[model samples]
Target: MTSPGMSITQLLPDGKLIVLCGRADDASAWQDLLGPARCLAIALDDAPHEARPRTLRGASDHLAWQHHAIGGLDGSGWLAEPADAFDPDHTATLVLPDPLDPPDAGNRRRFGFRRPAWRLFEDKTMVDTLWDAAGVPRAPSIVGDGTADLSVLGAIVDQGTGVVCSCQPRGAGPSAGGDGIWWWREGPPPTTIPTAGPGTWRVRLMPLLEGVPVRLHGLALTTRIIPFPPMELVTLPRPGQGTFLCAGAVPLLDDAADLVTHTERIGVGLRERLGYRGGFSVDGILTPSGFQPTDFNARLTSAMEAAPSDRRVLLHAVNLLAREGNEPDTGAVEQLAEDLFTIGTSCTIFGAATHADDRASRTTSVRWDGDRLVPAPSGAADGRLLITPSPRGWLLTATLATARLPGGGRVGPRAPEIFRVSDEVLGTNFGHLVPPFDTRPSACLPKVALNPEPATR
Candidate 1:
C-alpha cells in the first residue's frame, strides 16, 4: 500500500549530513540539490587545497557505511560506512560505482574505504539469469572462461551476425585507459558496428552453446576509449537523441519508469541470491523481442546518474540514509531535480584546508550561455577546471541554469547521442570560464594527453 517504502530518513549526532548522489554528483550540480546541508566535496584521490580530505566521492552515502560513519563541519563533514550516511535503513535504493566487475560466489562487499565495490556496478551472470527468468528480449549469448571452445560464436556468425566480444571472468586491460567492450553471443553481428580485431577479422567458433552459432554480446560499464580520465567517463547522449551514456536501460527510453522497475526487480533478485550489499549494475541489449540481459556487474556502473529520475530508487536511498541519521528531505531533493529540468539551477561547493595557496580559491570563468554549459578559463599549469576561489582556502564554482545539460550530458548538434566532449575544448577552446579572476603565478598543472582524431590512421 505504501509503495514498498523506497524512501527513508535519519538524524546525525552533529548537525552534519551526507546525501548520496544518485545522479550526476558534480559540484556544480550538488550546490542546489542539497542546499540545506553544509556541503563537503568528496574526492577519491588527493586534490588541491580546497578539495582536500578527499573522501570516497560517494561512498559516504552507501548502505554499508551507515553504522560506523561520523560527520562534522557543523553539518558539512561526514565519516561513515558509506551507504548509511544517506540512509541508515536498507529499505531500498542502491549505490553502484563505475567499471563494474563480474559476479562471483567469492565476492564480498566492503565499506568506508575504496573497496572493490567502490568501483563500478557489474554483475554478468545475475543479469543473464534474471532476464532468462523474466523473459526479457535479448541477444543470444555464450559464457565461459577466456579460453573456452566456442561453437556458439561460429553459429551466430554463420547467420551473418557480428560477435560482441565478451571477456568472461572480466579482467583488467593493458591499463586503465583501454576500452572494456563485451557482448552476448548471437547469430551474425549487427552491421551498424564497425569491424573488430585486426583487419576486422571476426573469429569463428566451435559449439560452445549447443552447436548453434550464437552471436556474442558483452557488458561494459567502463571502456578504454573514454575521452577523459576519472569522473568524466559517464557518457551522455547528444541533444535530442535518446540513449544511455552507460549500458542497459536503452530499450525503454520512452518509458524510463518501466525500465527502472524491471531493473529494480533484477537488483532485488541479485541481492537476495548473492548477499550482495554494495553497487551492482546490469547490462543488456535491446532486440526486436524486447530487452535482453547481456551481463551483470557484481560491482557498480556509471549509470547511477539515472537514479534521480526514478522515484522509487530515490525514496529507498533516502530511507537508507535515514537509518544513518542524516536524513536529507525527500521533498527538497525532488524540488531540486524539478528546478534543474525547469528553470535550470547550478551550484559548486568547495572543501579545502583553511590555509592553502593562491590557486586554492579562484575559478577563471563561470557563465550561462544559451543552454550551453560552459566553465571559464584558468591560467594554471594544469589548465584544470577545478580552480581555487578568490581570497584563498575555499574552492569556488558557479552554478547556473542553461539551455543544455552541463558537466555530464550530451553535446554538439544532435547532443542527444551518447558522447563526451573534451573539457579542454569547452574551457579553453570555447573559453567558457567564470572571470574577474586571477592570472598570476601559476602552480604545477597535471599534464593531460591529447586525443587522436578519428580518421588518423
Candidate 2:
C-alpha cells in the first residue's frame, strides 16, 4: 500500500531539484497543486517507529531548516537516535530570520533587492506612515523628535483622553509584546522616563480607546496570504511588571468575519504594495462601532504561534492555492482539512510571561530540587539546553516536553516532568470539539503565565 504523501520538490538554480518536507502540510497539497513534473513524496505522518527521523534526514540530500512540528527533523537526546544531522543549518534554525543573502557565481547578491517588507512593521514609525498612506485607520499618534521633554506629553493627556506612550528601537523600561514601553492612563505622559533621556529616542503617543482588543496572526507571503482566526486579547493588570498578563480568543467575537476580511485586506496590501513575506500579525481594538488597527508587527507575533489546531488546513491550503497548478480539488481538500482540524490537534492551549525584551533573564528556573519546588534566584539559568526559534521561550519549552513523550511504544524523555500552568494566569481556548480536550475545562487552559512569564501561542 502507498504511504500517505508529504515531501515535494523545489527547483534550485543549479539546475537540480531538491526534495523538501518537514513542515505541517501533508504531501497531497503539493501533489494536488503541482500536478506531475517530478514527485518523490514521503508522507511523514505514516512513517514507522525508529524510521521517522531517519526518513526525514535521508531526504536531506540538500540542506534545509529543521521543522520540529513534524518531529524527528530535529535531533534526539536518545542513544542511536535517528534524527537530523544538521550542524550547518542549526544556527539559522535557532534564531530565525531569513538567512542573510548568499553571494552568487561572481560573488554578487542576486535576490537582495527582493527583501521582505520587515521595515514597515519592525520600525513602528514606518508602519504608521505606510498604514496611514494606505488609508487603514489606525490610532492617532504624536511623533516627536528625540528630545528629553516628557513635559510635552501633558498637552495630549490634559485633554482628558488617556494616551499610550512609546519610543523607537523599543523594549526598555515598560514595554510588552514588542520593545518599547507602553501604558494606558488618562493624564499627561508619566513624568518619569523609563530608560535613557531623549536625543536617542523617537517617541509616539496615542489616545487610549476603551474598546475590546484583539490580535490576528497570519502569513504575508509574496503574491498570497494565509489568514488565521481572530483572537480576543484580555489585558490583565500587572502593577509590578509594568506590562500586563496577556491572553485570549473565545466567546467568539460578535463580528469575526468582518475582522477577518479587514485583516486579510491589510495583509494583502502588505504583500502586494510593499513586498512583504513571512509571518506577521495585526493588533487592534474591536470597538462597539468597528475594529481599529493599533499595532502591525511585520514579524510573527505570539498569537500566530498560538494558532488553533484546526487552522492548519487553512494555512496549507493557501500555499497550495497560491502556486500555479491544476485547480485544487477544493471539496476533497476541505473535507480532509476539516477532519484534520478537528481531530489532529497536538495541543490545546499556550502561555507566556510577555515582556518587550530580555528573554534570557525571564526563563530562569531553579524551581525544582527533585521533589521540592523552589524559586531559583533571579537570573539562574540551569536546564537541559533547549532552544526555540520563537520569542515565547516558555511555551516552546512546554510544547517540546509534551511532544517528546513516548508515543506508540517509542522511547520518550528520561525525566518525564513538564511544568504545569499556574492558576493566576488567564488562558484562551482552542479546538471546536466538545467535552474538553483531556477533561480539562476551557479555563483549565492548557498553557500558562507567571508574573512576567507563562504560556503563549
Candidate 3:
C-alpha cells in the first residue's frame, strides 16, 4: 500500500528509471517532475530545436523505440542500440511506457502495465455492450459493415440532426484520434467511405446528439470510484470535410448531478467486470434532457491535467500504483478530487493540427476583442497563445486569464473563434469551422430520457 506523501520514485522498484514519452513536452514535464539525475527522459519524436536539457530522440513510434531503448534490439539498420548513459545490469532499470501505448511482455515483467484484455474497451463498436452491462443510458446505435448502406442504417437511429459514423479498427490497433469519425447530414451519403483497409471494415452509427460536448473523468480505486467535474471537449466541425477536430478541453460551465452518477456507474462496471484500475473518461453530449454517453476511454485522459499543479504528478503516480495491483491511499485520492472542485479554476488547453514540419516555438499575447481574439501588447493580454511544431504537426495552445468568457458559459462555443484567430495570426490553416448546435426537442425528434433523473441546473 502507498501513502499520500510518497514520491513517485519510492513507489517504483529500486533502479534507474527510464521514461519513454510520445511527445517532447511530456518528456520535459517528467524530467522536471523527477529531475534529470534520477531518470533518463527520452522522446519518441525528434527533439524540438529549442527543447531544454537536450532530450534524446528515438524512433518515431512507441513500440519500436521502446524495444531499442531497453536493450531489446541491437544496433542494426536505422534502429540504434540502447543509449550508454545507464547500464541496465549494473543499475537495475525500470522503464515507464507511454500511457497511450500498451506495454509488451518484456516491459510488463519488469513493471506494472495495463492488461491487454482491458484495452478491448477502447473499441468504439464494442463499448455500447459495456454500457448496457453497466446500465448507463446511451444513444441508440447500430453496428454494421463499412460498405453497408449508411443512409439506410442512419435512418434507423437518425433523430433529425443526422447520424455519426465511426470506423472500427481493422486490425488489433486502436483508432487514431478523431480520424475515423464522420458526421453526415440527412442527405445522400458520400461515395468514398473511410475504411481501415481494403477488406471488410466495421462501422457504428448513431444519431448525432446535438448539445455541448462534455466528458466525465473517473478514478477506479480498489475500494471505491471517484468522479471529477465535467469538462468541455471543445470539438469543432468541418461540414464539407465530414469530420470534427478535437481541439482540446476546458472546465465545464456547470456541474450536473446526473453526470456524476453516470461516471460512478461506469467506473463500477469497469472495476467489477474488467478489473479496470487507474483513470478513465466517458465522452458524451450534455443535451437538454440529461447526459448521454457516446464513448469510453479506459486510460488516463487529458482531463486529469486540470487537477492542481502540485497534485498532478502525484495523481499520475497513484494511477500507476493502482495499475500495478497496489492499493493507493484512498483518502489522498479523494482529497485530490475535492481540491479540484474547490479550486474551480479552468485548465483550458486548445490545439489545432497544422500538418506542417516547421520546427519553431512562438507565443503571442492576445485579448478577446468582441468575438475574436486579437494580438495585445505584452503584459496587457487576457490570454497567451502558443504555437509549437510537434511530431504530428504544429500544436496551438491557449491559456486564458479566466475559465469562462465575460458573459459566462461553456468554452466549446468559442473554439471556432479561437481557431480563426490562430489561422489569421499564425497561419495554422484551420480554414473554417463551427461549434456544435444546442440539441432541443422537436416534433420530428422527441426528447430522450438518457438518465432516470432529470438534469439539475
- Clash totals for all candidate models: 122, 21, 0
| lDDT of model number 1 | 0.29
Candidate 3: residue 95 Cα off by (Å): 4.0
Q: Which of 1 and 2 is the better model by TM-score?
A: 2
Which runs in model 1 stand beyond 4 Å of their true positions? 1-41, 45-127, 130-138, 147-159, 168-178, 182-261, 264-268, 271-281, 297-301, 304-457
Ranking by lDDT: 3, 2, 1
Q: How high is each candidate's TM-score?
A: 0.37, 0.49, 0.82
lDDT scores in order: 0.29, 0.38, 0.64
Error of 3 at 216 (Å): 1.2
Worst-scoring 10-residue span by lDDT in model 3: 51-60
Candidate 3 wrongly placed segments (more than 4 Å)? 1-8, 28-38, 46-85, 90-94, 103-110, 190-192, 195-199, 305-311, 337-346, 355-361, 377-379, 439-457
Ranking by TM-score: 3, 2, 1
lDDT of 2 by residue, 1-457 (tens): 3211222113111221112232334344333433434322233333444433332211111111122322333333221122222222222111111111111111111211223345335455556787776557666677775635554663554334355566664331112343354554543344444655555677776655555556665655444455656665544333233333333322222335555566567777676666665546677655544556667765434442334423432334333322223223334333432333221213222334222233243233433454322334565322321223222322323232222223311111111222221211112111111111012111111111112222111
> Which lDDT tens digits does candidate 3 get at residues 168-261?
7556455645666888787855544653433557788999888877787878877788787666687888876877787766665554555676
Error of 3 at 407 (Å): 1.4
